[model samples]
Target chain A: MISQIAFVLVLAAAIYFIQKRFGRIRKNINLGKNRDFKDQVDKRLNNVLLVAFGQKKMFKRLIPAVLHLMIYVGFLVINLEVLEFMIDGFAGTHRIFAPFLGGFYTILMNVFEFLAIAVLVSCVFFLLRRNITKVPRFFNAEMKGWPRLDGNLILFTEIILMIAILTMNATDQLLQPISDHYPTTGELFFSSLLMPLFAGLNESTLIVIERFAWWFHIVGILGFTIYITYSKHLHIILAFPNTYFAKVEPKGHVNNMPVVTNEVKSMLGLVSAESSAPPTEPGRFGAKDINDLTWNNLLAAYTCTECGRCTSECPANITGKKLSPRKIMMDTRDRLEDVGNSLEKGGPGLNDGKSLLGDYITKEEINACTNCNACVEACPVLINPLEIITELRRYVAMEESGSPASWNSMYQNIETNFAPWKFSPSDRFNWAEEKK
Target chain B: MNIVTMAEFAAKGESPEILFWVGCAGSFDDRYKRVTRAFASILNSLDVKFAVLGTEETCTGDPARRAGNEFLFQMQAMNNIQVLNGYGIKKIVTACPHCFNTLKNEYPELGGNYEVIHHSTFLQQLIDSGRLKFEGGAYKGKKITYHDSCFLGRANDVYEAPRALLIALDADLIEMKRSRKTGLCCGAGGGQMFKEPENGKKDINVERTEEALETGASTIAVGCPFCMTMMSDGVKNKEREQDVKVKDIAELIAEAKGLS
Candidate 1:
């Protein structure tokens, strides 16, 4: 009964933590009206059947993929042991999987045990890889503290799990107490070889020891859950949801730009019937701030794994420009949070009620972008960096005539001359005559 | 009254010899003179009688359209379309991708719908049908890399037609790794042709031109007048004017026909 209570308690706790984390995600989104908000949830269901559960991106790097699969499946199998520990501990009979799992399960459990051991060993190698190669952002940055904690927790969980499995299998052999549900004489490879050591053991004493092993497994999993919720291991669960909402098609297409309403100074172009016409300004492009960016833009920032894949691919970054795609995402989050916090703390008098674009993000940073979708495309997870940057540009050029002098002249030319350079339209045929 | 596409225009009704809407780039820019001249020659070689829209041509306003200036683009597009309609010209061919894109794609929103073709595509059709023939070229040793104008490659899907023309003209086709749909900007889209590029690494065209040079090709071939000017400036900057050439596909065909 005590074991049953533990099972109920943990299941409730998992649900609770999951709900709490999701609430924060929802709160941020609902806080503001996003410009072009695509319904990500509906798309998510379609994506999973087509993309995620299909294991597409992981398999893109095929050589190491099989190993990742091994580790992934290992967690799933051990989860069965976790449930059984809870169930049997409540009923005072902890060998829940033995009878129904069958003679095949005898062999299956052995294989499951062996795989757990294999994955655990591989994870150690993964840990060492982190230490030796030490990828700058992924393994060594601010996220490092959580990974270090979670990595050891997973390692410990695996070690403790394997030990419990071995101990359970050895119960009959060592004459320790346990249920008869587990085949004592000859089961799978390990159990069969060791059963002889407990050949003379009686039933009741054996049952007692089995219950102890169940408790160890339950506690190990609970510890892992708490660690996972707070660590980089969080991606294990979060990546699925994040990937589901990932942008699939090109976001920079003229089709994808959100039509801004011309209400009280909105949008770069396309006036609503209600908006009053304003005089033309030229050479103005890009966003000035965080709110100036679209809601999808904020999602991109929040969803970024900070793996620096985008930073590596950026031409501007490679050429020693101040732009780092990784930092671009972080800075969006930081600036928004900073402003939000200040506002929350009642800091008065803001800068034009404008966004992170002109006020915080400089023209150079925005201009440095080629609007190439490379950074967006290269991301393993879907992050559309260009759209957010472009929207910011639209705000800068349209709202303020603070465009560069050349564009100022050019915009003037386009306005007066009807071409970007203000060249004479009469000259159109002059070219044909010159060829004569 | 003409709402037909190129394929339709090629198939049915009266064949239009000169749906000639001289684009603003062709009209205003001087280096583009060779562009319209070559186009005229290609039309003459095909024995197609065409009337020039002359002064009837105004800016198609693609620059204003893309720069988020809707009112100006609409004003310009409607004005040009009304002039073309006044000439009773249903089919139009342009040497400029900007005008072609604006009239074909964007003008409809402003109540102007007409078929427009870039000169490469129009010329390719003439060569394919055997009306226009470039028997051989006197030009030699110039390895050419074709730079795709954004209006042609991305806004429209006209990637291969120009390359096919270049191949038929016996020009060595060296490709920049980022050609076709992934083509680098000529630093001239989003109405940026008229404005200066924001302070960034190098000018987008210079970077793109470098990509052309990296292919070890001397002559950078282009389909649009805007690309012609930008790539020409890049070649001049690299001081490769003597060794490397920037020629429009029209200019290339002109050389092949010994007309220039």
Candidate 2:
């Protein structure tokens, strides 16, 4: 009875903390400007199914795809066993579904046990890939501090959690005959392999081990649930919404600014300028910071898992340029966090003086992007780092008039000559006029 | 061979079947001019009845828009749309993927809409409809590789049309390790063609050219004029200009048809 109450108290505390952290994230994401992703209901849902649920993009790399699949499938299936733990915690019953499920309970436990081992093995491989083997993607400049530690931390946590579940099952099978609370669902196939090691242990000692493992496994899961909100592992939840709201248009299309259109129309005499009323607050031309970006962009920043698939595939980064798409997403997230923290403290918020452009992301980084959409195509969760880069470029060009001199001249040539070069429009057909 | 203008078609109370959008590169770039002529020659031979926008044509503002000068982009877009809409143009084709992408996708939102097709797809369609036929296998069994233009490939999902044209040339179409959707940029897009690339270990075109050379193909087929210049420059950088020829798909098709 005491243990059951302790379990309920722990579960309540985990839920409260998880909800609070998630609420903070929701508020932070809402700070950005609004853009409608409400159109194309069917297509959005299809994206969620294929990109996020089916893991379609991950299959581009065969080896990592297979390894990730093992962990993904294992995490999903093993959680079914965790559901039973939740019920058993509340009811103070061992294997609560065992009586109703009868023989099926044994089959389910075996599958969960098999998956726990699979999860354990995959986690170990991932840890080695990050630490020992030092995959280039995992060792990029952005992955230096917390991002690197965060990657390894998740893997280690999964390994420990998997071991705890396996140990709990192995000891429970042994204690089934002696303790009434330990129901006999029949021998679990994977856990039975470990029966030889616990064979000579006393019944009381076996019971204590079984009880301790159960508490550890459940408590570890609750802790992980809370930790995920604060970690890059948040993608496990955000990937669904991120993929759903992904841009459905052709990758080549950059959205036109309607504000610029209106201003140009008035200048062209197509539409009369609004009577010079007392000047309203001036609107920002482009994203000077997170608040000027669309909510979709903010969602993308949070959804990024610091996966360097984008950086690895980036032509600019591949050629040793300062632009890393993964770093762009990370920097955006970090700056957003700073803004969010300031706002929570009732501070100046966006006017905190420092901005996303100069403080976090550098001018050189944004300029180096070719706007090739390689990063957009490479993202597993449909994060469009190119969009954010362009927005920052927009800020640089329009807001600051800070384009490189060569580009300014190119813009000038286009304005005067109707082309980037200083050729006459009459000479446009000269190539055709040339004699064969 | 005479090329007609859209103004001439409109003055004659007629509209050509399609308007050939001779982009800035197709008009000004010396090397790309040959590609422009090659495509025009094919259209003339096939009796496709196409008209060029000629002097009335202007930049599509792709560079302006990409460089973040939205004001300049809108001005250019609106001006071009007025001229295009004035003629009541129904269909358009261009050899430049950047122009094709802008006219097809970007122009529609600014009230300039037409059936825009890249030359690769345009040529492929001509072949598919039996309007285009090869006279001699000029590139027959010659190892050729197609370099995907970023705007054409991932930007607009045009991987097959260019490859299909190369296949029709009776050429052995070899692929680089990175091709199609995963294809690398030729260091020229987003106004990069107009300026130097930001500091980097090596130019993007050099990296892409190395991949093309790795394939050991004699001819590098391209769809975009920007890619043509970049790849040609890359080959020149490697001093393999004598052996490795970078030609537009239309130029290859024109050669195969004995039109150029």
Candidate 3:
């Protein structure tokens, strides 16, 4: 009875903590300006189904894709066992599904055990990939301390959880005859292999080992759930929604600001232009801070897996430019977190002197981008770092009035000559007469 | 080749079937000017009524807009829209991907809507319609590789049209290791052509040119004027200019049909 009450209180605390952390993240993302992503339901649904569920983009690299697919499927499928554990933990019952499932329970337990082993094997290989082989993407300059450590930490935690699960089953299988209510889960295929190690232990010792493993496994899962929110592993949850709201328009099409478009249309007499007073901040044309960006942009930052696929494929990065698309998304999230922390600590009216521009992301980085859309194309979950880069570039050009001299000259040429070149538009057709 | 201006066509109380958007490079750059002439010659031969904007034509402001000078882009787009609308221009085609992308995608939201087609697609359509027949000419059995312009391929999803035109030309169409959707940039996109690139291990065009050279192709076929300039420079750097030629798809089609 005491153990049941203790389990209930710990589970309640874990749930409360996870809810609080998730709520804070949601609130932080909500701080950005609103933009409608309500269009293209059918397309978005298909994208989510393929990208998040099917892991479509992850299959680009064959070896790692197969390895990852194993772990991903194992992680999802084993969580079903976790559900059974949760019910059994709260009810203080032993193998509650065994009586109801009959022989199927044996099959189900065997599958879960097999997955736990696969998860362990995959986790070890992943650690080897990151630590020993040291894939170049994992060693990108931005992945210095916390990012690298977080990856290893998650792998280690998963390995520990798998061990706990296996040990619990092994001890439970051994003690099934001695314990009064323990159901006979006829030979869990994988865990039964470990039965020899615990066969010599007595009933009390086996019961202690089994209960401790059960406690450790449940607690470890709860802790991992909370830890993921604070890690790049947040993609495990956000990938679905982020991909669902991904931009489905033609990849090359730059979205025009409707406010600016309407103003241009009115100026062109496409419609009766509403003449309005321009008293306030006229040069505030692009995103200078998190608040200036749309909510989807904020969501993208939070959803970034820091997989470095975008950076690896970025033409600017490949050509040794200052820009790394991964870094752009990271900086956005960091600056957003910084601002959110400041606001949380200091009331609603308090301001943080630092902004996403200049303080976090540099002008050099944004300028180096070729706008090739390679980063956008490379993102597995449809995160678009180019959108944020363009927005920041827009800020540099409009708000700060800081474009390169060459670009300014080109702008001037466009304004005056109606072309990027100095040639008169009258001479535009002169090329047609060329005999070459 | 005689090219009629929209103004001349209007004065004659007639509208051409298409407006040939002579982009800045097509209008001014020496090598690209030949591409423009070739396309115009083909259109003339086909009797596909087309008119140039001539003095009234302006930059579509792709570079300006891409470089983040939205104000300049809006001004340029508005001016060009005014001229295009006044002339009652509907169908438009350009030999440049930069202009094709902006005119088709960007201009519509800025109140400058027109049916814009890239020259490769337009030429492909002409060949399909039997208006321009592709014959085995100088490029017969010649190994040619097509370089996708960023604005044309990934930006606008125009991977097939250029290939279709190349295959129609009866040339041995070879593909670079990275072609179509996964094509590399010519290192001259997004206004990088106008400025020195940021310090890198190598230039993107040089890398792309290496890929093209690896294909063992004699001709580096291109669709965008920017790509033509970049790929030509890449070939020259490799000292293969005397061997491998960088020709636009329009130039190839015009030659295939013996238009001029």
Candidate 4:
């Protein structure tokens, strides 16, 4: 009864903390401008299946893909054990499905044990890839301390959790005969192998170890659920909705702002189609702050796994520019967090005088982007970093008129001559008249 | 060869089958002028009725819009749309991918809608219908690699038309390592063509050029005018200008037809 009470309290606290963090993130994302990505339901569903569940984009690099798939598929399948653990925790029942499932339960636990070991092995390799191996993608300028530590923490946490699970099962298998309420089980393949090691240990001592390991395994998962809200592993949950709502438009199509289009039409004396109201404020042009960007842009930032596939594929990054597409997403997410904290502390976000543009991401990085959409393509979960980059670039150009002199000249030339060159529009066809 | 303007067509109370949008680069850039002429020559030889906006033609404002000047882009687009709507133009074709992309995708939102086709697809259609016969002379048996323009390939999913045209030339059509959707930019999209590229280890065009060079094709076939300039510069950078000639799909087709 006491153990059940303790379990309920711990689960409640974990739920509270997780909900609070997600609530804050959702509010922050809602602070951005409105965008309608509501079309093409069937296509978005297919994209989620292909990209997120099937791990389609991850296979671009074969070794990592297989390793990741092992952890991904293993973690998913092994978490089924968590359902039984939850029932045991809540109802104070041990192996509730054991009687009905019988041999299948034993077989299932064996599969889960094998997968737990696979997950453990995969986590070690991931740690090595991040720490020991000099993979360039993992250690760029943006991944200084916290990002690196967070990655290691996730792997270490997974390793420890897997170990605790296996140890708990091993002790449970050893203690099942002595304990009255303990579920009767067949000789499990993996955990039973460790029976001889505990054969020398007495009954009371074995129960203590089993109970301790069981508590650690469940609590560790609960803690991980909360920690993931703070870690890059948030992608584990967010990747589903992110890939589901991923842009279904042609990759080359840039969405035109209907508000701005109407404004332009009004200026052109073409009847404003959607001009229902006059401008609210003069300062609105493009994204000067996070608020000016679309909510989908904010959501993309939140969904970033920080895997740096984007940075690896970025032409600007590879060519030695300041632009790292992964950094762009990270900075957006970081700024959103900052904004959310300020808002929660009872203040307007922009009133804090910190913006995503200058503070987190710089103009130089935004300018370096070729708008190639390689980052969008490379993302395993279909997060579009280019959307954020383009929005910031739009901010700089429109709000501050902060384009470089050459671009300004090009703009002026286009306005006057209808071309980037400083020639008359009437002379547009002079090339045909020229000697070929 | 007869070349008429929209104004002339309007004056005559007549309409052409297609409005050939001579994009800014094709109208003014010295290098791209040849591509325009080649495509025009093919259109004339096939007895296809097409009219140019000519002196009334302005830039499609692709560079302006991509450079982040939304106001200027709309200004130019609105002006062009007014002219096009006034002409009652329906089908449009252009050799430039920038023009093709903007006019097809972006213009509809601004109440400027028309069936815009890129010249690569148009040329392929002509060939498929036997409207343009390929005699296959100089390009016959030549090894040619095609460069996918970012706007045409990734933005529009047009991987086949240019390749189809190349196959019609009776030439061995080879592909670079990064072809189709995976194609690298020629370092000239999103207004990067006009501005000097930001400091980098190497220019993107130089990297893409090295990839094209690795294919070992004697001729590099291109669809977009911006790519034509970039790849030509890339070849020139490698000092392989003489050995590996960069030609537009239209130019290659015209050459095969012995139009020059």
**lDDT top scorer:** 2
In TM-score terms, candidate 4 sits at 0.95
Candidate 3 off by > 4 Å: A262-283, A347-350, B137-140
Candidate 4 lDDT over A1-436, as tens digits, reads: 9999999999999899989999998898899887677789999999989998999999988988988998998889988988988999999998899988989998898888888888889989998898888689998999999999999999999898888877778888877887887787777777777667778688888888888888898899989988887778898888888898788877777778666776777787777446646766645777767888888888888888799988987778887888899998898888888888888899877778778788888877877777777777788998988777666767778878998778899998888887898878777877666667
Ranking by DockQ: 2, 3, 4, 1
What's the TM-score of every candidate structure?
0.69, 0.98, 0.96, 0.95
Candidate 2 lDDT, A1-436, residue by residue in tens: 9988999899999999999888888898998888888789899899999999899999998877878888888977888888899999999888889989989998888888888888888888888888898889998888988999899899999998888887888888888888887778788887788788788899999988888888998999989989988789989889999999889989999987877777777677777446433344547888889988898899999999987999999999999999999999998899888888888889887788999999999988888888789889989899999888889889989999998888899899999999998888778889987865
Runs in model 2 lying further than 4 Å from the true structure: A272-282
Question: Candidate 3 residues B47-161, lDDT tens each?
Answer: 8899998877788888977787777778778888889988888999999888888899888876678999999889888878878775445667889999988899999999999
Q: Pick the candidate with the highest DockQ.
A: 2
DockQ of each: 0.22, 0.82, 0.68, 0.64
Candidate 1 vs candidate 3, TM-score winner: 3
Q: For each model in turn, which proportion of the native inter-chain contacts is also found? A: 0.21, 0.80, 0.63, 0.57
Write candidate 3's Cα lDDT for A28-140 as tens digits. 89988888877889999999999999999888778778878888888889999878877887888878899899899999888988888988999999899999999888988
> In model 2 chain A, where is the ten-residue run with the lowest total lDDT?
A272-281
The positional error of residue A416 in candidate 3, measured at the CA in angstroms, is 1.2
Docking class of 2: high
